[model samples]
Every structure is written in structure tokens, then in C-alpha cells.
Target: MSSSTLGYLARRAAQKERVRILYRRALKNTLDWAVHRHLFYCDADELRAKFDANKHVEDLDTIDRLINEAEASYEKWQHPDPYIVPWAPAGSKFTRNPAPPQGVEIVYNYGKEESD
Candidate 1:
């Protein structure tokens, strides 16, 4: 095979790997939203269908464009922080049921005392 053919194959293989990674990340994120095995199956199927729907594109440019658009959509929609804001009301674990400790004393200030 010609060098150009080998280069094209290499680029295609890299793009395929990228798509697989994106799909897996999307499925894991779906689990975060689904919260149940059954729900996740349904979500995964829907995601699979979205990719399957575009399986017939012969043009490399279209495939690359679709992959990029899918990736952008994934990045735009997915939530980064699963946990609640640390300082927001009802957010922290301690805030859920805050109470005084059984026994404790302030041994030292968090910061050094000022000379003044």
C-alpha cells in the first residue's frame, strides 16, 4: 500500500479510538444520571442508537465532523461536579445533620496569632 493510504488508515484508526473513549465516558455519565441498572440500559441503548444512526457515512470529513459535534455536545451537557457545593446550604455532609461534638476544645487557632 502507498504511504498516503497508510496515513489515512492511521488517522481513521485514531478517530475510531477517540469515538470509543467518548462513548464510554458518555455511558458512565449516563449512570450518574440514571441511578439504576434498568435506566442505564435504556440510556445506553439510546446512546448506541444515536451512533448507529450515523454508521453509514462514507465520507471521512462527515464522520470527523459528526464525531467532533458529538464530542462538543457531550462536553457542553455533562455535569462536572457530582457532589454538592461544599459551602452551599444543605450541601455538605456535616450540614445534613449538624450537631455539637460530644467533647472538644480549641487547642489552637487555625492561623498564627498576630503580634498586635
Candidate 2:
């Protein structure tokens, strides 16, 4: 358990963590472009394949480089407009009361008649 060996292990662990975080972010970003469940499934599968193809590299230097490259590509191709939940406060459909169409009459008057 030399100091140098411990440092190497720590660095390797940090690199692996960075890669995992990057992969999760990339997958979430893919959801921005795929609205439907089927579309998201297909897109996610392709993204997984791309990541799996590079999973065998044991060299830390190459792993760091690959992570940097992936991050750059993700930034470049990020969706300009991502979908927001309709019920979320930031979404366009978020409202306590929606506006009615123009020229439509809304009546709130009620009359009750009782005859015996």
C-alpha cells in the first residue's frame, strides 16, 4: 500500500466516476429529441451500443481522453429546445384556469324552480 499506488487507484476511480456521470447525462439529453417511448427506446439503445463499444479500454490516459471527447460531442449536439412536462410550472400548459376561445360565451347563472 504505497502512496503512489493509492494515488493511482484513487485517480482511476475518479476517472471511472466521471465517465459514468457523462454517460447518464448523454442518455438524458437523448430524451429531449425522442418524445415517444418507442423513439426513446431506440435512441437509447443506439447510445448504449456506442458506449459499450468503448468499455474495454484499461488505460487511464485513453479513458480520460475518450471522456473529454464524449463531453465535447454532447455539448455540441445538445437539443436547442427540450420538452418540459405540461404540468410543470415552467411548461406552457401550466395554469390553474385555461383561457376559453375567442367569441365564446361563458355563463355562470343558475336558476332553480320548486313547485309542489
List all candidate RMSDs to the true structure.
9.2, 6.5
Q: Which stretches of candidate 1 lie over 4 Å from their true place?
A: 83-116
Query: How many steric overlaps does candidate 2 have?
Result: 0
Residues 2-91 of candidate 2 have per-residue lDDT tens digits of 999998899899988988998898898999988898999999999999899999988889988999999999999888987778889878
TM-score of each: 0.66, 0.72
Q: Which ten residues in a row have the lowest lDDT in candidate 1?
A: 81-90
TM-score of 1: 0.66
Error of 1 at 18 (Å): 0.7
- lDDT score of model 2? 0.89
Q: Which tens-of-lDDT digit does each residue in 6-109 have in candidate 1?
A: 98899888888988999988877777678689998999999999988988886788889999999999888696665345678656754765665879555566
- The lDDT per prediction is 0.83, 0.89
